[model samples]
Target chain A: MIEHYLSLSVLLFCLGVLGVISRRNVFVVFMSIELMLNAANLGFVAVARLHQSMDGHVLALMVMAVAAAEAALALAVVILLHKHKGNLDTNIFSLLKG
Target chain B: MFDVMVILPLAATGAGAILIMLVAAFETFRREGISILGMGLFAFAFFIQLTVDNSGDIYPFAEVFNGMLVANTFTKVAGLIILACGFFSALAAQTYFTQNKGFVLEFYCMLLFAAFGMLLLTMVAELITLFIALEIMSLAVYTLVGYDRHSVVRAEAVLKYLMLGAFAGAFYVMGAVLVYAGTGSTSFAAIGAVVADSGYLSNPALVGGSFLILFAFLFKAAAFPFHAWVIDVYDGAPLPVTAFMATAVKTSIFAVLANFLLINPEVHQGWVTFLFYLSILTMFAGNLIAIGQQNLKRMLAASGIVHTGYLLIALVALGSERFSGGAILFYLAAYGVATLGLFVALSYLSGQDERRVSFDDFRGLAKVRPYSAACIAIFLLSMAGIPPTAGFMGKFYIIAGAFQAGHAVLAVLGIVSSILSLWYYLRLIIVMYFREPEQRFEVAELTLAPLGTIVLAVCVFAISFYPVVL
Candidate 1:
């Protein structure tokens, strides 16, 4: 059961990584970032169960909170990008080539 | 009680930031008053930090917050450098805004807030605390980067910085989760104890987690593989603000990196080889990039990357056997003071709207404004690691530490890289003194910034003799 959960979490993480690297849309990229974060959240839950401790549970919750804060900021940035370039494509925001 | 002295500046800065926020809400008080108040608070913090002993790490805030934060010798020293950076940058900014005229009362508020976050970063001993402090610093900085919303370049820079920064933050949380899974705790003390007992390397989870965390830090510090964003962002930000980020932000990020690395040898050993190669690549890449840059701010930004490489060498050479990473701290001091001084000088000489930003623009600067040109020359030489200056001493200690720590090849590469760095460092000096004046460069009548520059130039040597300052 634990192995299944861990495997599922790993799969989700890989998918998120793939999405971030392969997708061109800024919204998709941000959503991929969120997917990666939640995948890690899943790992935290699985590891917590395996270790039989409350530490992972609290950590998972803490991550969700941080993720929420990050999403808030990311959305604001997306809006800013939309205003400047009139598109949400990651490649369009290449004014800073570094 | 003396231990508490080290963190007083941090406390004062935080309180000062809150006060500025309140002051910003009122229409009666002005930006000038807030700027002065902020500088005064930071100056007081600097003195407090300067007077503290440098022999050991003080745990003043250790118990107050359940040891989540430390006020050790390393931290106290780093905090002082950062506070001083803030104070001087404020001085430069005050004169800068006089000409540019986009005076927002909350600029001081955000500056103080960022300083507060940097101070907290200096002593953060827990992963969660480090994350929170890092965000506080980065968040405030993002606002400052976009402080001039009128400029499209500035806006673009902030967008780039924010996206990259938030992405790094996400990695930090993921790493923290993995480390927590392995160690049952996230505090540095717990991690250190576990690493000491079971050895940190054997634990794959801890190793992977630390890599993720360190990568995020490298991105923040703008190290070798992760350093691309620096040139553009530094180029776009307002001149005074570029100086602040170059000095204060780098100082704090490095302080925490040293702290994390010093906690356990097992952890340091686990990644020594990787760190060794990364340092070398960072140094060479930085030198190569800086050599090609024509714009003065972009050159300084690239040089900042080279400085990060040197700091990495120090990090690779640092050991957990000793309580203090003295070489790293000293080098940071020397580097911080010189960089801040140069930027302050630029803040004055860059003129309104920064009409002069390239190396050629400074042609015959020595003939036009010899004093400012000479001041800039001093900073450039110090950065080039010329002898008798603090930069020379800093490189000396770090290279010696690298050798002592058994990284002989790294030390040799460090020397070679320093020599390469001189190519660009000297380019500006030659432009200033060797050529005849092209632009009749009118220097700013900014009493505060010029004085700030001279003070920092003196500090390039004064900070070298730790006993005198401490």
Candidate 2:
């Protein structure tokens, strides 16, 4: 059961990584990052069960809180980006090429 | 009592941030007053940090917080550097806003919040605490970068930084979970104990987990493979904000990196080979990029990357040394003084809305404003590692430390990279002194940034004399 859970977590994490790298839309990229973080949350839960401790659960919750704050900021940035460039594509926001 | 003293600087910065927030809500407190308040708060924190006296073995508030945070001499000095960076950047911002039009009262509020997060970062000894501190600093800085939302460049810079920053944060959480799986604990002490009990390289989970963590740190610190975001982000941010990011943010990140690396000699030894190659690549890569840059801010940002490489060399040496992070901290102080001095000068000289941002824009500045040009020349020379300046001394110590650790190749490469860096740093100096004065350099009379620049220029030389522990 632990192996199954860990495998699923890894699968989700890989998918998220692919999405962040392959996708062009800014929204998709952010969603991909969220997917990656939640995948980590799943790993923490599974690991907590393996360790027979609640530390992983607590950390997962803290990560969720931080992820939420990050989502709020990401949305604000999206709106700001749209106001300037009128597009959601990350490639379009290329005034600073570094 | 020691706990209170240990927590005083963090408390002061946090309280100051809140105080600024509350005061900003009222219409009576003006903009200049708020900048002064922020400076005062940073000064207050600096003094408290100075007097705390962490030279002894007293962990101060170690047990009170369950060792989640520790304040040693290393942390105290890093704290002082962060606070001083805050103070001077606030001074720069005061003058920056006076000439430029975007005057939001809450800018100081955010600056203090960033400082608050950095102060916490310096003391955190636990993984969760480090994550929280990292986010607090990143979030505040993201906001500060895009504060002037009307510009397309600023918007673009913030987006790039935010996306990459959040991605890095997720990587950190994933690594933390893996490490927890390996050791069943998230504390540094617990991990170090585990590494000691069953060596760092022996455990697969610990090995993978630490690599991921180092990747996140290197990304944040703008090291070799992860440094592409720095030039654009630093170029897009406002002058004073860039100054703050260049100095305070780097200091806090290096402090945390040193803290984590110092966990165990075994841990350091495990990654020395990878770190060695990365440091050398980072130095040459940075110099190559900086040499091609035409913009002054971008050049400084690229040089900032080279400085990160030098700091990496210090980290590779950190394993063999027992001076306990003293060398890294000394190099950080020296680098900070010169970088901050250059930015403070840029804040005032960059003119209204920062129109003069390129090397060509600063042609023959010495002919019109001799003092400002000389200050800039001193900063540029210091950055290029010329003698009798702090940059030279900082590079000297890092090379010496690396050589003492038997990493002679790394030390020689560092010197070569600094020599490459000289081409760009000197290019700006020559551009200022040699060319004919075309554009009239008009600076505001009541600005505080010039005063701040002069102080930092003095600090560039003054900091070199302060002897390092080893």
Candidate 3:
């Protein structure tokens, strides 16, 4: 059971990384990052269960709070980018090179 | 009482941040008043931190809050550096906003918030505390970077930094979870105990977890392979914001890295070989990027990468034998002074929305404004690691530490990289003195950044002779 959960966690993390790398849309990239955090949350909970302690559960809660904060800022940035360039694609905002 | 004494500075900074935010809501604070208040708050914190004598009784609150925050001489000095950087950056921001519009009272609030986070970052001794503090600092910095919402450059910079920074943050959480899975505790002391008893390499989860955590740190520190984001992000932020990010952010990060690595000799030894190559590549790659840059801000940002490389050398030299925290802190102070000096000078000289930012823009500045030009030259030379300057002593201590650790090759490459860096540093000086003036060098006569520049230039010298008992 532990191995299965850990495998699922790793798979989700890799998918998040893939989404971040492949997607050019700003919102999608942020969602991917959120996915990555959730994957870590999964790992934290599973590890907590495996160890029979509540520390991982507490850590997962903290990570979720931080993720929410990051999501708020990311969405604000996405809105700002849209207002500036009239698009949500990351490639459209490339004024700074090198 | 000891706990309160240890946390007094942190409390003061937090209060100052909240006070400034509340004050920003009023109609009277205005731009100049808020900047001055910010400077005052930082100065207040610096003094508070300085007066709390922690040198003699090492670790006053060693087990406070479940061993999450430790206060030794190392964290004290790191906190001092961060506060001083904040004060000086606030000084520069005053002059920066004098000519450039888009000033808001909340800008100072964010500055204090970031400093508060960095203060926490330096003192964090637990994985969970480290994550929260890192987020606090990152979130504040992201807001500062994108503060100028209309600029496309700022937007791009914030997006890139936000994405990469969040990625790194997530990596840290994952690594923390893995290590928790392996060790059953999140505290540094507990983890060290575990690593010492079982050995660092015995557990697959711990090894993989530490690797990921180190990767996250290196990304934050702007080390090699994770360094490409630094130039653009630094260039994209406002001048004072960049200075704050350059000095305070890096100092806090290095402090945490040192603390993390100092947990156990076995753990550090396990990673020394990998860090050895990473330091070398960071230096050379930084030099290559810095050499090719035409924009002055981009070049400074790239040189910051080179400085990180040198700091990495000090980290490599730091074994479990003797604490090399003093060397790292001294180097950070020296680098902070010179880098902040250069940026403060640029803040006033860049003139009217920073139109003149490239290397060619400052041709023959020496002819028109001798004093300002000389100050910039001193900063550049100091950054180039010339004699009788703080940068020279910083490099000396780091290289000596490397040699003492028996990493002779890293020491030699460090010297080589310093020599390579001299070209760009001197190139700026040569352009200022040797070329013909392209435009009229304008200055805001009643500004504080120039005053800040002069003070930092003096610091570049005064900090050199600061005795480091390594």
Candidate 4:
């Protein structure tokens, strides 16, 4: 059962990474990052079960809080970019190429 | 008394931030007071940290926090650097907004929050704790980067930074999960024991997990390959913020890196070779990038990459057997003072919307305001590692430590890179003195910035002789 869950978690993480790199829309990219984090949370829970401890559950909760914080900040940046250029395209925002 | 004293600085800043937020609700509180208040609170906390920090005391409260936070001498020292950076940055921001328009009280609040996060980062002893602290710091910084909502350039910088930062952050969480799976524990002490006993290379899960975490740190520290983002973000942010990020943020990150490396010799040994080549490449690439830049802020940003390279060398040469955090801390202190001073200087002189840009803009600056030019020259010289300045002493300690650890080739390469850096560093000085005045150099009230610059110039020398403070 633990191995089954862990395999699914790995698949979800790979998909998240793929979505972030292949997508151009800022919203999609951010959502992809959240997906990646959730996948890690799933892995944590699986491992916690294998180890027969509550550590994984605690870690998942902690990661959820952090993911929410990241989402709030990402939304603020999205709004700021929209206000500046009326678009949410990542490629369009390259004014400083450092 | 000891517990109360140790936690006082953190409590004060937290309370001050809340008070400022409440004040921002009023119609006429004015942002200037918030800046002053922030600076005062930081300075007060810094002094309190100085007096209260007693190494290895392990306040009961800190332990009760479940080993997540460890307020030792090292953490206290990093906190002092962060708070002082905050205090001086507020000084620069105060002078800056007199010309520019974004004077919201929330800006100062964010700065305080970032400092709070940095303090936590330096003290974090658990992986989950470190990740949370890191997010707090990065989130506040992203907001500060785009505070100028009107500038498309600023908005773009924030977007790229946020996207990449979030991406790296996910990598960090994944890394932590893998490590937890491998070791059945998340604390540094447990991980260290496992790595030490089992050998770092043999633990596939921990090994792979560490690489991911290290990649994220390198990206944050602006090391080679992951370094391309730094220039644009620094360019888009206001001058004062650029300075704050360069000094305070880097210092905090390096502090955390040094701690992680100190965990076990075998663990670090596994990564040393990659770190060695990476440091050399980082230095040369940074110099190449910096040489091609004409804009002063972009040039400074590129130089920051080179400085990170030198710090990486310090990491490479770090003795795995010992837990000496001295070299890292001293170098960070020196870098913070000089870099913060330069940005503070730019904040005052860049004048209303930052009309200055190219190297030629500063030509013949000595003729107009010799003191400002001299202060800037001192900062540049310090950065180039000239004698009797903080930058020089910083380079000396790192190089000396590297040589002692039998990494002679890296030390020599480090010196060579330091020499290469002089080209860009001295270019500003030559422009300031050699060329005839091309543009009329303007000055403002000369209040906080000039004061900050002069003080940092003296600090360049004082930090070289840090034993005095010790």
For candidate 1, give the lDDT of residue B287: 89
- Number of the top-ranking candidate, with lDDT as the measure: 3
Q: Which residue pairs in candidate 1 collide?
A: B57-B72, B57-B73, B58-B72
Q: lDDT per residue, candidate 2, B1-470, as tens digits?
A: 76887778888888888999999999899987898898898899899989987774344446664577877888989999999999988998988887786678889889989998998898888888898899999999999998887788888888999999998888888889789888988888888889888986677778878878888999999999999999999998988899999989999999998887887887677778988999999998999999999998999999999999999999999868554588789888988888888888888888888889999999999999999999999988888899999888888888988998999999999999988998999999899999999999887888788888888889888988888866
Ranking by lDDT: 3, 2, 4, 1
CAPRI rating of model 4: high
Q: Comparing candidate 1 with candidate 4, which one achieves the higher TM-score?
A: 4
Candidate 3: DockQ?
A: 0.87
| Poorly placed runs, candidate 4 (over 4 Å) | B1-4, B57-63, B320-323, B468-470
Question: Where does candidate 3 stray beyond 4 Å?
Answer: B56-64, B320-323
> Candidate 1 residues B1-470, lDDT tens each?
75466667777888888888887898887767777887887887788678766556555656675576777677877887788788888888887776675568888878888999999998898876787789889988888887674566777788778767877776776788678767877778788888888886678878778888878888999998889989989988888788899989999998998888787787677768888888898999988999999998899999999999999998888883332477777888788888888888887788888878899989999998888888888888899999888899888888877887878999999999999999999999999999999788776563588888888888877766663111
Off by over 4 Å in 1: A1-6, A45-62, B1-7, B50-66, B320-324, B467-470
Per-residue lDDT value at B238 in model 4: 80
Cα deviation of B222, candidate 3, in Å: 0.6
Q: Looking only at chain A, give the TM-score of model 4 against the true structure.
A: 0.96
Model 4 per-residue lDDT tens digits across residues B1-470: 66666667777777777777788888877766777787888898788778875688363345465556666787788889999999999999989888887667888888888888888788777787888889889998998988777888888888878888988988888888888888888877778888888986677788878888888898999999899989998998887788889988998898888777776787678778989998999999899999999999999999999999999988987764342667778888988888888888888878788888668888998888899899999999999999988889888888887887888999999999999999999999999999888766666764677888899889888888885211
Clashes of each: 3, 0, 0, 0
